[model samples]
Target: MDARPLLPSNEPDVASSPLAVRGLTVSYGEKPALFSVDATFPPAAMSAIVGPNGAGKSTLLKAALGIVPRLSGTVTVFGEPLARARSRIAYVPQRASVDWDFPARVMDVVLMGLYGELGFLGRVKAQHRARATDALDRVGMADFADRQIGQLSGGQQQRVFLARALVQDAALTLLDEPFAGVDAATERAIVAVLKTLKADEKAVVAVHHDLSTVPDTFDHVLLVNVRRMAEGPVATAFTAEALQATYGGRLAVAQLDRVAPR
Candidate 1:
């Protein structure tokens, strides 16, 4: 994990950012993948970056993390630019994007979370190893620590990757389809952790495709489609017109569920 002190200096100008994104844009060679988009994620809310395929949900998240080269605009985590503050952040890539075929064990994969800060090619220290194990236990992957990643079930793999991110213990996390291809139980577990992150005052942005769970899983929403069409409190922004614009009216009756009033 990043042992760095909480850099309160950059904490999102909560009043200004939530997740202030401006002039944001992206492209794939000659083709434009995203347009001049702008958005903000309200603080202390579970936000879902949602849209149909090709809506640029993934691209938006990637741009926020600097994983993709943005053509223009700025992405600020808290108040700090993501490029200048990676250690303060954590990312969980899409499961399908990983090499499940690789020869690493569950523990090894989680340990990579430390490789970013660990000495070049040096062995992982005891504390880092312990952190990995603790992360596994947190995600309920403790028993599978020694097992090959490919030998585990789809749910197990997802937890393992999350454990890796958990080890980072970042104040902000961005997950790309973390619930994809997982079972109900796994989905529940991941959602529970997401709640924990929010309870801990961390900001989380999840790229979600299943509109069914959007209501229950998020308090805020960012509707995308090669451009940011709308973003705000879930109840207000997750409207039918926004969905139509983002999905090109191609989405079936949106199966979005509603959160029970507190």
Candidate 2:
């Protein structure tokens, strides 16, 4: 697969980045998941966080969003603390992490995205419903809006979740393994939606596992292994040396060729 065109040579200013983390560290009890990790995801770009299993890719996203407790470090959204910028961010946890059995319809899940604006006691207005429907349409899940979320196929459910995130119209959208367990058609649909988001100048960051798609799917990448290993345009940071350092000996020669071909 060919790499996408690179973003402008001039990197975004640190403070202007959609998401920025400095000295971030996270631990569960005594086991450290990430240490002094720092990363900045630029606006209007698609970035992938890739590493081996247990390499802290998910931990980095969780810690940066304060979903998991952090041992140290600060996370900034548009140069401000998370609290001041919370409304501008939207997150989609891994599909495996969600309890799909919950008795909610697809539309109900999408509307939840507006909870911040519509107070708990507030009513859902016509405009709100319209936005929710539009989001579902964008992900090609509009027909399933009334269907029980648990009844949909894995790819369909993922599309519904993406629709939910779209309703928020967030400036920075964070997703955990969006392409996991999906069919080829679903993956193509999701990639198209992500590119539309980028075209609209929204920042898209996802924890991705399919190394083969990185070059064709993302504009920038962050290679991690409990710490920041390499990060920049895919052409520069996604090198054989960096991949070797990040994955160690876990990647087979053939797999390595697919990711960073000779």
Candidate 3:
């Protein structure tokens, strides 16, 4: 698979990045998970956050969205604080983090994405339903709208979560380990959806565990290990030295091919 380099033309202006993290630090109890991390995710491209387990990839995503408390620094979405632009951001948490057995229908789950715009307890109008339906259709899950979320397969469940983000019509999206438990077909489908998002100039930042797919799936890469090691176009920044530095020797030589400059 050819690595898709971050095109210079797609790069967003520094003064107005889609997502920017500056000196960000996150801690759990007294232990720090992320340390002074800084990175900018540009619009019109997919940015993959890659590192070994416990490297704070997921923490970075959560902290950026204010889901987890940040011990220091700040996150800006579309050049503004999260609070000022909350409605323009969408998030898809790790599939495992969600309780699939909660007994909600697929459509019901996707509708939750509108809560930001509609207010948490606002009534779901017909227009909202139509948007959710359109989102489901984009991910090829429209027919599963009536099925219980818990009954869907892992791939189907992932699609539903993506649909939730899509329906939000956000300018920036954060996804945590979306491809973790999905099949090849599902991965392909998700990649297609991501490309579409990029085409629409939406910024996508995802916690990606599969190193083999990163180069082929995303244009930018942020390598971290409790701190940001490297970030930029995958071709120029995803070097062997950087991978070794970020993964701390856990990354195998075989996985190197996926990130080799095209």
Candidate 4:
């Protein structure tokens, strides 16, 4: 694994982190969702965002992408604001967030990824379609290209979303719960795709809940519970202490031992 250093709070080094959040605060009306959260995610590695439910794991990703409003702080992608770096980023939101009843076909959905570079009115051209087809093939969903998105299974739908992200060819990919509702086979396939992304030196950050697989699935982790409890290489940052802090004794000791093992 090509381990990268986490950036210090005072230093705003662009090259060190693919995604950087500093003093980030978010709220839903008066109630705070996240507070003073800070962390750096690097390239050439897969990082998992782990915490209890409602830990603002999804909010952190959204704020970084500007999909959600931030109460304060900044999110930098490859050293610049999100507007300037939009084309270089790809995001897969949680599966449950989508309207499965939408009338779009699989091909139509995957083609959406190109909208950043193609603009709203730009023609999608034959080559772009071919690229989308190739991406679908990579995710094992090529046969479903013409099928309605609502007709597919949960795992299949997840693959189509991944295919969309793959077609973007982005340097940084943020995924919220890729494994949610996915079968073992789909999970393995997704991990394989993530490995390919890391091999290409892309940064892949995912919100993951399955603690047992974290050690094998990612090289780094961001343990958060409203505020970031820990962030770094999995071996060092994913400790019993961090887990206890982030989970607040809700986690079983056996699980912690398996995850951190002293």
Clashes of each: 2, 0, 0, 0
Q: Ranking under TM-score, best-scoring first? A: 2, 4, 3, 1
Off by over 4 Å in 1: 1-18, 253-262
| 163-196 per-residue lDDT for model 1 (tens digits) | 9999988877889999999999999999998899
Candidate 2 lDDT by residue in tens digits, 18-45 = 8989899998879889988878888889
Candidate 2 has an lDDT of 0.89
- The residue ranges of model 4 lying beyond 4 angstroms of the native Cα positions read 1-14
- Please list all clashing residue pairs in model 1, or write none if there are none: 12-78, 12-79
Worst 10 residues of 2 by lDDT: 1-10
The better-scoring model by lDDT among 1 and 3 is 3
Worst 10 residues of 1 by lDDT: 1-10
Q: Estimate each model's TM-score.
A: 0.88, 0.94, 0.92, 0.94
Instruction: Please provide, for model 4 over 148-235, each residue's C-alpha lDDT reduced to its tens digit, 9 standing for 90 to 100.
Output: 9999999999999999999999999999999999999999999999999999999999999998999989998998888778787887
Q: Which portions of model 3 show Cα errors greater than 4 Å?
A: 1-13
Model 4 residue pairs with clashes: none
TM-score of 3: 0.92
Per-residue alpha-carbon lDDT of candidate 3 for residues 1-262, written as tens digits (9 for 90 to 100): 1122321234446557888988999999888899988888877789999989999999998898888999899888888988898888889999889998898999999999988788867999999999999999999999999999999999999999999999999988889999988999999999899889999988899999887777778889888888888788887777877787777766667776556542
Give me candidate 2's TM-score against the actual structure: 0.94
lDDT of each: 0.79, 0.89, 0.86, 0.89
Deviation of model 1 at 138, angstroms: 1.4
